[model samples]
Target: MELSQKRFVTIICTYIRAVNGVYGGAAHDAHVWSLSNERQYMPSNYQNGDKSSWLIGDSGYPLEPWLLAPYRNAEENSLESLHNEKFTKAKSIIERVFGILKSRFRLQYAPKKVVKILNVCCALHNICLIYNVEAPTVIEINEERSNLALPNVDQNEFSRIAQTIRDRIKISLRS
Candidate 1:
């Protein structure tokens, strides 16, 4: 019997800063472990009892009051499924942003070049989006390359709060 190749995974999280109530800058991904352990990127409203504000994340992230994820085992035509649909639509915006970034910058494929060139590319990317500039046609990058397994994280107080909020969203979607 032959052994198959073993693969390693790295998690990337994007940080978007708000200025004048408008989102600015291109998205940047931090390694998952760092995001799991750090608090610097957390928004002020997250800790100030602002229940209305939340982020849409995938199953890779733990449920938190400020982060909504799709429900496990959501059945077809159910409220959970509907919630997941809306959540996915919101998530697709991020996906499209990355697709545009990679399509415009060839250097993005090289890991060492990413940090040095990413900021500039992201700034240009935002500019393109603002002016509705058409991106040059290029070979499509594989979007599923980073489809890694979810990281292991213990459920905590924030996760419970996030789940509670997800439930509320589902209920609202039902009616």
Candidate 2:
């Protein structure tokens, strides 16, 4: 199978929050996110009435009240552009963590128990963080294309709410 066909999805904060490896590479990121147990529980666990917490997702994922995505086709030097810039910067941490995980442990050569292996690696990665272990140097590679299409603006009420929340954040970043 091609490397793209073996894609897995992971959520990371200071450490891995969730990892889903059941989907094949052809699965769209939004589809995976929509069905994830983590996503189901996010409203209860993280989001309350305050709207103080949210997960940052890439363009492949849909915008939701509990999740935020960068504004697509944002104009140059605009507030939306500024938000995307800051969003990219903040999102780099997850990429760096993945780099460290891959560099420290070779996942490509692992056996068929890939999902278990991924979970174990994530756990170990967190342990390294807790103990202050030095991370391996990350070798940057060209990012793979996502299977999902970029999200289009939805006219539904739920989507409008999400867009409003995103707009609030974009405006806040102006200060």
Candidate 3:
């Protein structure tokens, strides 16, 4: 579900999955941002090479990436470590939630029967809270899931943009 303001309440009874992290249900709000917009806004506040800027987070739960601007001026050594620790710990709940959905609820795998798919997804969803079993890897992502490694994008343009973002951030810190 696409939310404009806040997503504290959007995490119930939905797929709870994120795709490319652009648009998704539930936990996606933490890291979701339009590069189109952020590219314009963040540069003014944060230097591109500022690794700290990458951590500016509005996740509410303290587990998400710190929003670039805030992260730039944070306690990099200790706070980053603490934030990472908390983020790792907090992510387990989401993982378990997906695990239950896939294993007990059987949502991860595709249903073969056309007539009973809805019924099955619904029934399993209810029973899942009680059964809580191993996640059944039912639905496998196609080329879509593994695209990060393949790099189908235009290398030159992508590199140029990345370098620009990096250079700009780096230059900002010198002042």
Candidate 4:
């Protein structure tokens, strides 16, 4: 079911690290991401090429040095498939954070200034985490239902490096 006309993008790592992109629902995820301030300034923050600071993204996102997307059409029992499995598992945390946000805030009821409201909600959520306050409820997300099979983007030099990084991680997972 479509949530709303407004599309909100969030980056969560135990806490909501970034909340951005209050675009219309029709906006492509990758397009919104490309225009995000966080994406624009990410290089400066991680100029050292820290392999450990990568972000996990869905197929709708473009693969980049700092962002890892799952392999398209990965064969069963292959290293890519194993990587996808682990990637999905790691990505699920963000999904749960969304579930908690929606359940607690009932974002659907916000009539206007939804972006500001969303930012406030994220801040409050983080504060709750800091104080060890329990969320009143959390919506259970169905991982399979949310999966999108987007076409692979044309590989650029940076994406090629990301592919190598992903391959190294995939191989390491097998050991």
Candidate 5:
């Protein structure tokens, strides 16, 4: 029997920062570990081309596209629209990460032993990835989603802003 290739897995916990709330004893502390990733990535950031870790988001925090406009490349048309869409899509990773974190590891609710449990679960998540180990969990998942509401971004306004961002990015990229 031939052995298959072994793959390594990294446990990533995504969380959002509570800008005005107290979490784990620090105000606006990087409360959500890998959780904050929702607002982190943009679509254009991932080209499936370069190993661009600068924008790869293994760093601290991803800047908002509006503010990150200055760093965009100029040669591409419709870049602003593309980048905005990319950012929105990138945020989805955070959601999926969180969903798995909560459903699989039972990380929901603020428990007194949160950090402790998280450490153990994160380790397990990583381990299972490498061994192709099956994470057999007893918790039965419900079919209904609770929070599926949409954001309040007006489509017309968003298009206008997106266009402006593209223009600005072009100017910045050219300079």
Candidate 6:
């Protein structure tokens, strides 16, 4: 799902599975879906090094030429620290969007027909956004599930290219 930081709106959503699904299951791995689905239509501008249009995501997301993720590990006062701070601030907007979803739709305990219900909720959310309806003041809380083991993504040519892009981004941030 995509969220607009400026508008507090859900920009795009693709249902994979319920929150109860296995952490590393095909439906739950963000990187897998991203590679197969969203990566296909990445714009030529981003591919040609236009950072302005890139997507920013958390560590759970794979670092790609068109996606920016915070540094995984960094020393105090390091460039990575500054990058991570900025990245986290930007990502927090999505976190609030999720909270709004849970509050307005009770997504955590959504009953049978999970995907269908979630999709409907997302559509309704967008409608509410369009109408400028006030979001529920009481945001629901959902604990994050445990981290899953890394999936066996192949370290092939694309991975190498993505890594190179990430390295350049890190260096640029440092400078």
- Backbone collision tally, model 5: 11
TM-score of each: 0.67, 0.83, 0.30, 0.83, 0.40, 0.64
lDDT of each: 0.51, 0.69, 0.35, 0.69, 0.36, 0.53
lDDT of 3: 0.35
**Per-residue lDDT of candidate 2, residues 1-175 (tens digit):** 0011125655546677677777744466677777888777766764456466677777776676777777888999999999989887777766666667778886775344666687888788889999999988764433443445655557555456778988988889767
Task: Tell me the deviation in Å of residue 69 in model 6.
Answer: 1.2
Q: Write the per-residue lDDT of candidate 6 for residues 4-51, one digit (tens) a residue.
A: 211111233322111222222334335343544345555465667664
TM-score computed on alpha carbons, candidate 3:
0.30
Q: Where is the poorest 10-residue window by lDDT in model 4?
A: 1-10
Candidate 3 on 68-135: residue-level lDDT in tens? 11122236555544444454444444444444543544433322332235344545555654576445
Candidate 1 local lDDT, 54-168, one digit each (tens)? 6655564545666566776799999889998887777665555545555777653544445455566666766776788987676443333223343332446676666778888
lDDT of 6 at 113: 46
lDDT of 5 at 81: 44
Q: Which ranking of candidates, highest TM-score first?
A: 2, 4, 1, 6, 5, 3
- Total clashing residue pairs per candidate? 2, 0, 14, 0, 11, 0
Which candidate do you rate higher for lDDT, 2 or 5? Answer: 2
